[model samples]
Target chain A: MIEVKKLRKSFDGRTVLHDIDATFYTGKTNLIIGQSGSGKTVLVKSLVGLLRPDKGEILFDGRNLLTMTSQEVKELRKEIGMLFQGSALFDSETVLGNVMFPLTMFTSMSRAEMLDRAMFCIERVNLKGAENKYPSEISGGMQKRVAIARAIALNPKYLFCDEPNSGLDPKTSIVIDELLSDITHEYGITTVINTHDMNSVLGIGENIIFINKGHREWVGDMSQIYTTSNEALNDFVFATRLFQDVRAYVAKHGKI
Target chain B: MILTNSLANFGRYCMFLTRTFSIPDRWSVFGKRTIQEVSKLGIDSIPLVIIISLFIGAVCTIQMQLNVSSPLIPSYSVGLATREIILLEFSNSILCLILAGKVGSNIASEIGTMRVTEQIDALEIMGVNSANYLTLPKIVAFVFFMPVLSVLCMGTAFIGGWCVAAFTDIIPVSRYVYGLQTMFTEWYVWYGLIKSLVFAFLIASISSYCGYYVKGGALQVGKASTDAVVSSSIFILLFDVILTKLLLQ
Candidate 1:
């Protein structure tokens, strides 16, 4: 579990995150949802040590991330895995090579052992025969799956995905979402996803935090999302007629 | 303001080099990458080196023959002058300036594209020292192969001059070979090789630095590549003068 306390970040005196406090539980999918320009990206970047917050305590299972030394940070990063929005696979490496990279860099595994582990990851992501193909040879959905496979190759304690569903079709987005949810539950990894995809929010948003203009507007699970009294989140999440009718039906039937 | 910014950039460049010289996390990976880079940056440049050296060598011979044809000037002076020009300047400094355009821009654009596409971020998130992992092998490969390239450039240039003498009425091949052999201070070759090594390091590191810190998107990457070439060329010329004064004096 990761605990954030009074996280404040600013750039050139313009505050991006204003004294934010949140907890991301282990073995759960923690979704940070907001419109564009919200501080969700900044928050995630700070959590992963990509950006430093001006003032706050980011404790990863009781260890303060800010106070850690450079070496400590590096040691901690080996236990963390991230899936970039663009599925930032090395353009030069094939799928098998990409999955084997972290193992090669971090572990003492022999070549055959690394290959076996990478093959297992590929199989887990359902990309069995595509190991020899380059990232450019695959579709965006496949690339995301490759990224997911690469992310889990090390079986990290924490997993961060930055807009994992962006640029993917609805069907592919659901697949990616379900995969993330399954992985989080299976490995007991503290999985945090930054996304504005409402389908993701309503589908597998086990613990959702809605941010509005650099502030946490609401916090709830899917069960309580429609019954929330937050106007901003309602306007943003249930803006479409389809969602509004669903909200009406949920209100009338008291069901999801 | 401009001076302050320049100072800051220089400081940042120093810091970047410091980070880039760390011990590799895995020696096997380093070995593999260095070999790959030697092929990419060094072996691939052989054709360009041969072509340029040949043309310059032939031009020097022709120009020296035309200008030094007077009775007061010995017949061997054309060969001597061409040899001096190729050995002292063209093979080392000029070649590096040319490569500062080719290899330097290539490194800049490739790394800059990686930066814009978040590949570097991905590497960093995986706890890899992205700077060292990406830039060190290129620097090592270029610096290590520079002496070989210099020797090859010198040999190919002499061959070019030999071709000119054998085919044309500019000068006799025997005289040119004799002039090349005459008063050939082996230290000059060493000096050129040393200078080439420094220039190669400059080209690789400066280009990598330009690319590594690239922000924004495609336009910024294009600008960084241009900046890498221009900056490396300028530094190569500057170092050529400094090294010549220091080494020759």
Candidate 2:
């Protein structure tokens, strides 16, 4: 499990994350939802050690991430995997090369073994036939899958994905969500996803935290989001007429 | 205000070069990447370097002839001047300035794009020292290639002078040959090469520093590319005088 304690971050005297605390358990998909510029990216970045918090401790298991020595931090990083928003695969490397990179960098595995491991991850992400293709040669959805394959190449204990569905079609988005959900369970990895896509929230958000104006507005799962009386949650999540109608119908019938 | 900003940039540049030497996780990774960068920044650069060196050599010879029309000094003196200027200054310093615009901007934009695109962050999150991984190989390749390119420039400059003099009725062939061999100190070649080595280090490191820390989007990346070339050119000129004073004086 990953635990954040009173995390606060500011940029040029403007607070972007305000005294936020949350815990993400292992073997579950935890989603952070907020409107653009709502500090969701900042919050996730802080959690991933890309941005240092102004005040707070991020405990991966029990060790404070902010206080760990550089060597210790590097060791801890080996247990973490991140899928970037743009599917940040190296432009120079093929899909198989991309997936094989972390293993080549961090391990003494033989060349044949690395290739096998990489091929396995690529197949797991359903990108088996695209092994030799460059990231640009494939579609955006394929690129995201390649990114996922690369992220899980090292068999990390924690996984983080930033906007995994952006620019993808609805069908591909669902495929990515289901893939993430399957991996979280299969690997028992603590997974954190930052997204504003309502479909993702309803589909794969086992634990959801909503942020508004740099503060946590509500925390719940898909089953609990419909019944939350929080003003911000209602305003944002049910802002659509269709969703509001569904909520009203559910409240009246208690069946959704 | 400008002074403060310049000082701050200088401090950051110094720190960046200093920090790149702290050992990497794997030396083979660095070595293989250095070979790759040599192909990118050095091998591919040869044609342009050759073209520029030849033309500059021709121009230097012509200009020297124009400046010294007096019959007393003899045409051989012009050849000597052309050889010295091409090797000691133009090939090393001016060629570096050109590369500062070409290679320097490329280093900045490529890395800046990687930065904005989150590729560098991806490396860092993998526990890789992105700085050493990205820039050190580039620096190593430039340092190794610059002196060789400078020598090539000098040789081509001499050939250009010979060809131009042969085609034109300007100077006798004997005097030009005499000029090439007369009072030629092998140490001058070493001096010019040393100058190029220093300038290469400046270009690679300064341009990389500009690129690696770039923020924002495409516009900011373009800005970083411009800043890299501009800063690298300025530093190359400054180091020219400083190294000349330190080494040649």
Task: Give the top-scoring candidate (lDDT).
Answer: 1
Candidate 1's docking class is high
At residue B82, candidate 1 shows an lDDT of 82
DockQ of 2: 0.83
Model 2: residue B63 alpha-carbon error in angstroms:
2.0
Which pairs clash in model 2?
none
Q: B1-249 in candidate 2: lDDT tens per residue?
A: 999998998898778777676787788888999999898998888888888888887788888889998978887988889888986788899989998988999899999999999999999899988888899999999899988788888888888888888888878767877888888888888888898999999899988999998999999999999999998998899999998898788
Tens digit per residue, CA lDDT, model 2, A1-256: 9998899999999999999989898999999998889999999899888999999989999989999998999999999999999998899899998999999899999999999999999999999899999988999999999999999999999999999999999999999999999999999999999999888999999999999999988889999987889988888888878888887998899977
- Which residue window of length 10 is worst by lDDT in model 2 chain B? B16-25
Residue A58 CA displacement from its true place in model 2, Å: 0.8
Count clashes in each candidate, considering only residues at least 3 apart in sequence or on different chains.
0, 0
lDDT for model 2, please: 0.91
lDDT of 2 at B112: 95
TM-score of chain B in each prediction: 0.99, 0.96
lDDT of each: 0.94, 0.91
Which residue pairs in candidate 1 have backbone atoms (N, alpha carbon, C) closer than 3 angstroms, thus clashing? none
